[model samples]
Target chain A: MLEDKNPQKTKLEQLGEFGLIKHLTKDFALQQKSTIKGIGDDAAVLDFKDNKAVVSTDLLIEGVHFDLSYMPLKHLGYKAVMVNLSDIYAMNATATQITVSIAVSNRFPLEAIEEFYSGVALAAEIYKVDLVGGDTTTSTKGMLISITAIGEAKDEELAYRNGAKPNDLLVVTGDLGAAYCGLQVLEREKEVFKVNPNSQPDLSEYTYVVERQLKPEARRDIKELLKSLEVQPTSMIDISDGLSSEILHLCEESQVGCNLYEDKIPLDPTVIAACEEFNIDSTLVALSGGEDYELLFTIDQKDFLKIKGNPNLTVIGHMTDKNEGAHLVARNNSKIPITAQGWNSFS
Target chain B: MLEDKNPQKTKLEQLGEFGLIKHLTKDFALQQKSTIKGIGDDAAVLDFKDNKAVVSTDLLIEGVHFDLSYMPLKHLGYKAVMVNLSDIYAMNATATQITVSIAVSNRFPLEAIEEFYSGVALAAEIYKVDLVGGDTTTSTKGMLISITAIGEAKDEELAYRNGAKPNDLLVVTGDLGAAYCGLQVLEREKEVFKVNPNSQPDLSEYTYVVERQLKPEARRDIKELLKSLEVQPTSMIDISDGLSSEILHLCEESQVGCNLYEDKIPLDPTVIAACEEFNIDSTLVALSGGEDYELLFTIDQKDFLKIKGNPNLTVIGHMTDKNEGAHLVARNNSKIPITAQGWNSFS
Candidate 1:
C-alpha cells in the first residue's frame, strides 16, 4: 500500500525531468558486458555479437493491472520487471538488459517514485540485468509502467511456442493457483479495511499466497536446470494468463490439441486450503488463476525420464492430434473443454 | 481529433486480447531480415549478428502529451512511432524493429484502435521497420502509449552525445520551431471550438506548421545523407526537448561550451509568419520551443565545405572550450546564457 514512508514529500515538478531521472537512476550500475552504454545517452547501445537477441515488452496500468491500496510500490515495481523477464525465460534465453518507462501523475511524490525505482534496482541486481534506457513523463491520471526486456540465446537452444509436436509431454514448473488465491486474500482484506478503517486483519496465515501475489519471482533458473539435465523443450511459454489460456495459446500456435489431466495439475497445500475455505473448485482455480510466473513447456517423450522424478517439474498433459481438440481429462473420468476463462484486461 | 469516423463501435472486450492483437497486426509483414520471429510468441527473436544494437523507449500519456480534442488518433499513433524512431536515428543507426504497448480505457472502440494501428502500420512500412511485438492492456483513465525501437549499426558509424570537441561545427537538419508553433495553433483552435462548437476555423494558412505537428516525420534519411557526403557526426541528438535543452545536453556530455548564433537558428517562413502573427520572439521560439524532431549534430570543421550551402543542413554554432560556457550570441552582439526553458512535462 502507498503508506507514506518519508515525512518530507518532494514535489516532482521541483526536480524537473532531467533532475528526477538522474536522481532515480544514479545508483544503478551496469552489470552486463553486452551493455555498451546505459543511461545518459539518446539510446542505450548493446553488442550481442553472435548470440541471437530476444525481446519482450509489457504495459501495466494502475487500477486495471494493480491496486495501490493493497499493493506496495516496491513490490509492484519488482513484479513488473519479473513479468517481462518471465517472457524472456520462456524463450529459453538469458535476460541481460531492460528498459523501464513510467508515467505518473502529480499525486505521486518524488519519494514514491524513488521507492518504485529502488524495487526495480533490487530486481536488476538480483537478476544481473543492466538498466539500459527509459523515458519518464507525467500522466494525467494514475500511473503506467512499460518494461522491455532484452535477452540472448544461441540459435539451437531457443524455444518457441509453435514448436510443440504431437505426443510431446507437457510439463509445468512449481505449482499453480497460488497467486490467484493470493489476490483473493488481498481483495478480501481490502474490503474488510474499507468497511472499518481501524481494523487490522492478521495476514500471517495467508503468507505464501500473499507473497505469491505481491513478490512472485520469475523462473529464471529453469533454463540452466533443463540444460544441465540435457533436456531440451520442444515448446515453452510462461504461465501468466492462467493454465487454460496459456495452454490454448500453445495449442493454437502449434496447431495441436492437448489432453491436460486434472489430477496432474500441481497445487500447493496452501493454495488448496485457500480454495477450500473460499468455497471455490481447486481445478477451476488452477486452470483460471493467473500470474503464477512459472514455466510451462513440452518435452519430447524420450527426454521425459530426465525430468520424471524432478520435484520442481510435473508432467501435466500431453500434446494430441489437431482433431482431438483441447480438453481436460477430469479426475472423475469426464472430459471437459478447455477455454480461455483466464484474466482478460478488457473484461 | 478523436472524431467519430465509424458509426459501428465494436467493444474491445468482444475480441479479447489475442483476437484484438491478431486482428490489428494481421496486415503487418515483417520486412527486416534480422527479425527471426514476430508476434504470437513469448518473445520476439532477432539476429543482428555482428552489428551493434541500439534501443530507445518512449512513453506518451494522453492529455499530458497530446490533446485529443484537435489531435487525431491516427496522427498520435504515427507520431508516437516517429518519436521512438527519432531517438534511434539520433544514434546514427538504422531502425529495424519496434514493440508498441498501449493501455486504453473502455471508452475507445475497436475501430478507433484499428485507426491508430493503421497509422502505426504506415509508419512501419515507410521506415522499413518490422512491428515485432507489443502488449495491449486496459487503462483506468486515458490512453498511454509506450514504444521501444530497435536499431542496428556498425561500431564505427555510431555516434554518441559525448563525442564532440572544441571547434566542431554544430549542424542541424531542416528547420526548427515549426512543431511547437503547430501545437500553439492546435491549442488555439481547440479553445475556439470549446466556446462555439459549430465554429470551423480555417487551418489552410497554417498547413506547414499543422502538418509538422500532426504528421511529423523522423529524419530517417539524414544518416544516409551524411554517409553520402563522407561526413560523420562528432556528437548527435534529436530535437525533442527544444534546441536549448538539447544544446545543453550536448555541451554537458561533451564537456565543451557552445557559441550558438541567434541569427543562424533555422526557422521556416511559416514559423516566422506565425511568430509575427502571435507576437512572440522568433529567436526564443526556435530556441525554447520543443518537438522539432530534427537531427542536431556536431561535425569536424574540415567537413564544413561539404555541408556548406546545403539547403537541408545548417551550421548554426561551433563548440568552444569548456571555460567559455554555453552561450547564445544575439543579433545585437549581446551574449546571453542559454538555459533549458523547454517543455517540462512535470510542470
Candidate 2:
C-alpha cells in the first residue's frame, strides 16, 4: 500500500508553522470540566467555583526578539512579565501569579541574571504577581525568556472576542501610536549612536513615549474602573499587534463588521511629531504600531451613557452587521476597509 | 553612596547562572495559600484543596540543547514532552497538562511542523497531558523549544528531595545509565554516517538503548504501582542527572547521607554490554550516567517490605546519618565513597 511508504519521515522544514500547531493539538481533547476554553483565543478560560481562570504565555529571545545593546535587561525582564499579564487584562482579569523561565548559557554571569531577575522581581512586586515557578538552563548562543501569567475572574466579568453586536460603541483606552513612535525614536537613536559615539541623544521630550515602549503598563486600572462603573465590554482584545490588527481580530471572532472614526482616534502629539520626523503616516503607526499593551473594547449603547464622561474610556466608533463590512470613517467622511498589517516574523 | 555606583548593571556573564537565579528570586514573597513551595526544588508544589499541583519547565535550543542534524524532529518533540513530564513524575504526582512553545524560521515549511506536532500529540495521548497553550514565533537562528508541565498529588502523599531520613532504604526504580549510553551510541552513529552516508547504521543490537535516548518514558506506572501497593516514598527524585547526583540532592535536602551496593545497582543487559564494548566501566555508568527518567526514591523500612519481591523495585541501599558520609558497598564488601557527577548545565 502507498500508506506503507510514510511521507512524514522527511525533515520538519516541510511542515511550516500552522501545520505543526494543528497536527500537535489535534488529539488534545479538553478533559477538565473547568476548562471552558482551551487554545483557540487570546487566553484560555477555566471555570473555577468563584471565578474563571485566564491563562496566557509569551516567549522572548535575545537577538531574535531583542538586542541587549539597546534593550536593558531590567526593561526586558519587566517587559516580558508585562506582555503576558496584558493578555489576562485583555479578558478583564486581575493577574495574580506568573511563572518565569530563563535559559542562558554560561556566557551570562550570575550578576547579569541577577540584574535580569532584579527587574523581574521588581515587576512582580509592583504587579502583585507571585514569582511562582521557573526553570534555569544553559543555551549555546543567548538567553531565552518565557513567562506564563494566570489570572482570575467571575463568570459574569470574563470577556470574550466573540460577543460584539451591531450598534455596540467601540471604546479604546488611552492613546495609540505613541508606543509605535517610541520604537522609531529608539531605532533612530541607535543608528545615530552607531555613526557618532560621542553624540548625546536629545530625547528630552519623548519621555512618555519611550516609557510606553520600555516599561509599558498593563491596564489593571481599567478593569477596576469598569468594575466600579458597572460596564462590561461585549468583545475585547489587547493592542499587542497595533489597533488595526486588533480590530481585525475582533471582527473575525465576532463575525461582524466595524466602523471606526479617523478623527476620534486617539493620537498623542508626540506621535504626530515623530511621524513627521520618520516620514511615515501617523494613521499607519496607530494602525500597525504594536506593543502598546492597551485595551480595546466595545460597550453596549446602554452603558455608553454610564461610561461617557469617564476619562479613562474613549469612544472611537461602533460595530455593524457582518455584510456591512469592516470599515473606517476617514477625516473627510470617506469610508475605507480596515485591515491588519501585523508583524510577520517569518518574513 | 556605594549603592549609587550600583554594580547591578554588570554584565550577566559575570554573575554566572546560579548567582543570577539567587539574585532575581530573593525578593519574591509567596502570597498564594496553594503555593506550598515555589522555586529552588526539583519541582514547585501547588497545594489544592483535594490534591497538590507540581510545576516545572525546561528549555531546548539549537546548538547547545540538541543538534537537529542528528536528532529527528519527531524524536525532538517526544524528548521535549518526556523531559517535562519526567519532572512531575519525579514529584510522585500524575502529570495533568503542559504548554509547549517553539521558535522557528521560515526555512521550515508547513508539513515539517506537522511531523513535530504529530510526535507531540502522540506523547500527550500516551501521558494524558492536555496541550493547554503555547506561543509560536520566528527566530533568527535555529529552533527553540520550551515545555512547562503541571501535575496533581495528595498533600501528604507528595515526596520532596529533602524527605529522606536516616535508615530509610535508598532504592532506585528500573535500570540506570542506559539512556546516557544510548546517547553516546547515537552520537557515534551520527559521526559515522557523516563519513559514509550510504553505510547502514548497525544499531540493531542497541535498539532498546537508542530508543531510550530518543523516547524515554516518564514512570507514570510507577506512581500508580506505589499507590496500589500503599508505599509512600519518604524522598523521591528522577534520574535525569545520574544516580550519584540525585542521591546527593536527596542527602543535601534531607541533611542525611547514604550507602549503596555496587552489585545491587541495576543495569539493563544491553547497557552493560554497550559499556563493555565502549571500554567504559559499567559501575561508573551506573553511577554517573543520567537521563534514565527512572524514579529514585527512598522508602522507610516498614514500607520496603511491600516492594521487596517485586520485579520493578530494587533494594539498592539504605540512607544513613549525616556523619556516615555517602558511600557504596562494593561486590567484595569494601565501602567506596560516592561523589556526585551530576549534569552541570552552568559549566
For TM-score, the strongest prediction is 1
Model 2 C-alpha lDDT per residue in residues B1-347, reported as the tens digit of each score: 11114444343333333233344334434444444334431113233445545556677787766777767788888889998888788778878766677776545543444456767777877777666556666666677888877666666667777789999998888888888888889889888988998989878999888888888888889889999999998988888878888887788778998999999999999999999889999888888888888888999899877998888889899999999989988999999898867765554
lDDT of 1 by residue, B144-222 (tens): 8999999999999999999999999999999999998998898898889889999989999999999998999999999
Candidate number with greatest lDDT:
1
lDDT of 1 at A153: 95
- Candidate 2 runs further than 4 Å off: A1-51, B1-50
CA shift of A240, model 2, Å: 0.8
Interface RMSD of 2: 12.4
| lDDT value, residue A23 of candidate 2 | 38
Model 2 in CAPRI terms: which quality?
A: incorrect
Residue A238 in candidate 1 has what lDDT?
97
Model 2: fraction of the reference interface contacts it also forms:
0.25
Residue-level lDDT of model 1, residues A294-320, one tens digit each, is 999999999988998999999999999
Candidate 2: Cα lDDT at B85: 86
